[model samples]
Target: MAATGSVALALYYYYVRGETQRGQFVGLWPATILGLAVSLNLEQMKRMLQDFQN
Candidate 1:
């Protein structure tokens, strides 16, 4: 959810004004990095949870 929100925000910034809350870094680059991180974390956490379940 966080990853998706970040990506969606980035896209909106890029297409809408090419800027974001924290400037270009926030607008796209960092957002992308954070999105990737969040997504990977979610995936990893999901796997860990599944492992625990099993």
Candidate 2:
């Protein structure tokens, strides 16, 4: 959901508002957010497995 919003904002800046530089910069946010989400999920799973073992 948050990633979708970020992409919409990026498109708005790029096409609607015609701010190329800003759009390009904002466009990178979704990937960053998703990457963090994946990393956090992995960490959470690791912790869950450790707890299960003990």
Candidate 3:
């Protein structure tokens, strides 16, 4: 959801506001957030598996 919002905002900035540099900067945000989410989820799943084994 957050990633989608970031993309939308980036598009607005690029097309409507005419800020290419800023738009490109904002565009990177979604990938960063998604990477972080994946890492966190993997860590959480590992912990859950360990707990189940105990």
Candidate 4:
């Protein structure tokens, strides 16, 4: 949801608002958000597995 919003805003900035640098900066957000989400989920799964074993 947040990533989608960021993408929309980025597009708006790039096309509608004509802020290329700002748009490019905002465009990087989705990857970062997804990367963090994956990292956190992996950490959570690791903890769950350890808890199950113990």
How do the predictions measure up, each by TM-score? 0.51, 0.94, 0.94, 0.92
lDDT of 3 by residue, 19-51 (tens): 999999999999999999999999999999999
Better of 1 and 3 by TM-score: 3
Model 4: per-residue lDDT, tens digit, 1-54?
888999999999999999999999999999999889999999999999999999
Off by over 4 Å in 3: none
Residue runs of model 4 more than 4 Å from their true location after superposition: none
Model 3 has an lDDT value of 0.99
Worst ten in a row by lDDT for model 1:
20-29
Candidate 2's displacement at residue 27, Å, is 0.4
Q: Which ranking of candidates, highest TM-score first?
A: 3, 2, 4, 1
Candidate 3 vs. true structure, TM-score: 0.94
Candidate 2 TM-score over all chains jointly = 0.94
Give the alpha carbon lDDT tens digit for every residue of 1-54 in model 1.
565565666677767875656344444555567878889999999999999999
> Pairing residues by index, what is the TM-score of model 4?
0.92
Candidate 2 runs further than 4 Å off = none
lDDT of model 1, residue 27: 46
